[model samples]
Target: MILRSPYPDVEIPEVPLPEFLFGAGFGDRGDAAAFIDGATGSSVTFDELTGMVTRIAAALHERGLRRGDVVALFAPNSPAWVAVFQGVLRANGIVTSANSLYSPAELAHQLTDSGATMLVTVSPFLDRATAAAAQAGLPDDAVVTLDPVDGRTSLVDLLGSSATPPELEVGPGDTAVLPYSSGTTGLAKGVVLTHRNLVANLLQFTPLGTTDETTRILAVLPFFHIYGMTVMMNHGLHRRATVVTMPRFDMAEFLRVVAEYRLNRLYIAPPVAVALAKHPLVDEHDLSCVDVIFSGAAPLDAELGHAVARRLGCVVLQGYGMTELSPVSHSMDERHPDDDLNGVGYAIPNVESKLVDPETGREVGPGERGELWVRGPNVMSGYLNNPSATAATLDADGFLHTGDVATVDERGFFRIVDRVKELIKYKGYQVPPAELEAVLLTHPGIADAAVIGVSDAEGEEVPKAFVVVQEGVTLTADDVMAFVAERLAPYKKVRVVEFLDAIPKSASGKILRKDLRARENA
Candidate 1:
């Protein structure tokens, strides 16, 4: 059964991302504060942002960056990062955004795989960036710092060039950004997002957000991630909203900035929602200004989502997406503030989705769980230089197999169950880890938890949980087991419990389940 967006399709303009963003409709707010540094309160006006982008483009073009060349942005979230990102696109170059938390080796892997010719970073990260650049065989001169550093090329140097911005040579089909993702499974590979992919998602998502010139968006998530890149950075720019950028997420600092700036719209991952719902620090701040809290990058428990909504007295929304779909295919429309918080509401404009049985390769109707296949202009073209992986994911009909199990209702509301590969089979019964994780999170003693399939002494596969107990709460393994047992089926009960100080997560806020499996094997 194919499901189309409930909303009318918005026309996608056949223009490059830079042209579409800086041209008629999106860029007219000249002097408005486009971005603000949460820590310093410095602002970048729309005009100033455009000017910086122009100068940076001119400088990069003068320094040998050409069409199809790849530039690696390894810096944290900042106005300068935005400038460089747009600048590279303006110069007809592709951008590969690297996670700011990447180690030298990890960064090197991306730099090498993406075939990045130059790297842009800040002074603090210069050591690792330089090491990775060297490992990737990038020349020393190819490393540019966003902040001024003696003996290094800096943003100041880039903007000081007198050369004019190069002519825009790319079209809508040209590559824009390469954000790495593990897709359904396996190692992280670059997902080739074109100008049309980015721009189409922007148009498709804009109607559902309710953002305008007056909206204040808190961008605490890393901009390197596709969720932050497309949803927060580009969408904010497209909507002319004031985006407050934070280099890192600290609970105290996050609360302070939101309260201080009176930020209304918050884009966050599920992990941050935990703090808002349970952390004592949240109550210390005046969060009445918050209007909506949007969560993505992972499935959020409905119980926890309600807790956050009740505590903040704001509308809580959740969406479903993956990096390959230009990050957003479904979202809860702001118009329906009372929509079920558990389901990611209707598909956005121009998006078509299908719930197909993975085992049977048959279409499934509403209320049946199946793998989600999304087709839209926003769907990524394919993985870079990985044809086998691309063929395995994106079909000839243009539907990208998301590999996530989902169910849709009669009203077209979609609920994500879990990854097809992550489901636990106990005694021939299927148990979804997300369901058990949601149940585990409801326990008052549990702060955070992750469910994974582990082999038992009898060689049978069963569900095991890695939990983080709430601080100052005394909870035992049996108590945890009983808490879930009373709430779930026998097969769905967490059979093993291990306490940890924290759960490992990526910069995008996805739980590192592989790390947990490796630890179990070790």
Candidate 2:
């Protein structure tokens, strides 16, 4: 079933987004429970959350913050993390989320790039946040710690100042979030998402499929990332659905939550899907109740997508969106949701997507692979502080030139083939590493796989396979290469197989392709 755009054309709001998000759930007020921490069984109702957010907003406002201000949230996924997310919105400030797991160097880059004046973080991350702040030229007033230490103000105490929330001018064009994109070719760049960009996405998901008061979701996906921020946090709350938040994914616990909460909707990345489908432990846990399984951030193989669906008797839907797009431009229509269970089904409400040649701007026809370009309210305003990169990625026409090469079927179903910049040129024909990796995942013995291009003695780039074997399974390099050669085209075949314990991933769940490229150079 082709997903139809509800608006056909993206409808931009004249006002800012806090008004939209605030109004979305307040009516439920005391009745709606917003977040349920899966780990601790702790839950926060919408009214309680809004109260905390109001106090947080009041404290921040008293501390000299106002509209259009940029604040950074660098912490693990927890009730506090989410409270602060909404607090920033209520305070009329933009938020830039940094992963709690990031190294000082990685954290420093985003802090500096986004020009975040103040930061809210937990105790364990104080040193890293302090160092990053200094590097970013922020002084003592700029760093605020949530779990108080000697130097930092207590978040709880700060909230006691006033029950009243801050009021300021914030609009659709006024930036609301600065989520960094997982740049395929270079350093991660901050994608500027306005309040409209965010609210539009929340609305866009409304028409994608069936989501309402009855829907229950497993919110293990990181809130700092675009996918979880939009699909799990914003959308779930907008619909007044119960969100069972898992700080991290443990296979047994994930199944436990599904069974206990009767979780109907699940949004997962490719790696997690691989674990659910192939892991033996999955059998121990009953996932028979799941309604929607969404895989994004990376490609999910059709065989794997079909396997999970068949096992649970649930329709698997693959969605395609990026940090800049408020992340859900194409979600399968629930009516025909299973039609492209293997495909990233049709455009979401009010969003427009086009496939074009990477080198040339010319559009492609049905089934022809090309770089995908998207434009909508869901699309971000631009990259933070980097006009050059922003200008390069987003043309004057406002379409985000996503570097992903994909093909669309006649029915509006699309498949992300590989990254345009990451494609390996082998003997002049383009070799998609993702394609080879998908084939690698289909192998029974393989638990995880990442494909990168490496230079051969012949002075041409060749596909190299990095394989992680399943527990208790063993394989030789030649064996894995032979397995790939049988399935892939001659040029696209894996020429080298390197065994790895596991593939590295960013907090947002993107495989660090650049690290593999560095290893290739090594």
Candidate 3:
């Protein structure tokens, strides 16, 4: 059989997207704890949050922004960061959430590519922001500073506005969120997510909140990443559950939050699993409230998941999806547990998945391994400004061809087998090795650097770099890893390195990663 959805597409609401979710669930729960920001020790209620969002929309409208305009948000996990996002959405404007640590050049690339009209960022990055804004064709007035900055549109001023929006209509099909995907081999393309696309996925997993009332969830994954953005934050808020936010992951500090907040659910990536299995700090914290721990982005070793689950007295579950899919296509709930930890879990409701043989591009048997393709409302409309790429990734019938090598069992569970592309998923974040290779080449002392993903203790992969230095210059593995660390995001950091004489390449000069993996095994 060819790859076709046995089920039809999930229904999308024809109503205007932004205001459609107001007062739907969590009635009279506005005063309930919604977000507990760890960095500043601040807690915000649902009512407080919606009010802030409304003001943000009013201020943006006052500045002449209209529906479909794009705003860029570059900040960590803070209450303010989320408020800006909801404000952007509530106004019927889209937001591009950039990695906070991204270099000015990186920010400029995304801004220019996405044609963002405005930017909201922290005061600390003003200089870089200003320069990047110019490069992206934005004016000084377009820069909205989230904190006290001498010469910028203050976020406080926007928050103080009390004007009501024009009672506008929005719907699930309208574009609301614009997150970039580290395209398999090129520039990161903006993945357009309709409010309905995201709202649908959030509601699909809302039933998993059975214990959320008594359980606080650790929100360490970057909200900028779709998995963390929708799965944890949006879902947690819709459930009226408390979210304990961590701007950055610190092994020691992470364990402390669990004890401090009595956290019950931990939505983490594979690296955390590897650390918990051996990190001494895991033993010190009180994790009694932890009931379900879901890991994603990178692969999870069944052995490691089992060991960590046994040690922590919690259930370790694995999940799978990509940015183009509004992230979550499937996950292991309490019912399936570790039986399908290696698999992403059963096909989620409203989603139809298929496993196609690589050579023939035809569907395979229940136990056969192939490429996983999906058709659902959550699938992106297409890549921004790149029709060729959009056509290459999304099929004629709207099925997204997820390049992961996987197999689905008779029970509908899918397991990722290998990868067909050069993207590196470090703890659920895309760290394309080619991007790193391009950066490494700019260093004068470095003759060449070839980066590849190496398995961590938990079976997830991190970039392990092999470098060859200029004949006259002496270099060490430590020097190379640190060099990349200064330019990459936390998850994209290079953890291990080795000095190499040469990197295997083709006649046209493409790094042969499979050969490198084979050499590592040998």
Model 2 scores worst on lDDT over the 10 consecutive residues at 1-10
Worst 10 residues of 3 by lDDT: 1-10
In angstroms, how far off is 17's CA in candidate 1? 0.8
Model 1: residues with Cα > 4 Å off, grouped in runs: 25-28, 182-184
**Residue range 1-522, candidate 2, lDDT tens digits:** 122354455455566665676655567445666788788888888788877888888888888888878899987677778788888888888899887677778888898888888988878888888888888888966788777678677687777876466665676778888988765567889998887777778877676678788888888888888888888888877777878888777888888888887888898888888888887777876677798887877678889898888777787878788887888877777766547555777777776678898776678877787888887777777887789988988988777888889888876777788888789999999998888888888898999999888888988898888899999988999999899889877878888888999898776567888888888778
For residues 222-260, write the lDDT of model 3, one tens digit per residue: 888888788777777766778889988888888888878
Model 2 clash pairs?
A: 16-171
How high is each candidate's TM-score? 0.98, 0.94, 0.80
User: Local error of candidate 3 at 218, Å?
Assistant: 1.5
lDDT (Cα atoms) of all candidates against the true structure: 0.92, 0.80, 0.75
Superposed on all Cα atoms, the candidates' RMSDs to the truth, in angstroms, are: 1.2, 2.4, 9.9
The runs of at least 3 residues in candidate 2 whose Cα sits more than 4 Å from the true structure, single-residue gaps closed, are 1-13, 148-151
Looking at model 1, residue 468 earns an lDDT score of 98
* Model 1 TM-score, 2 decimals: 0.98
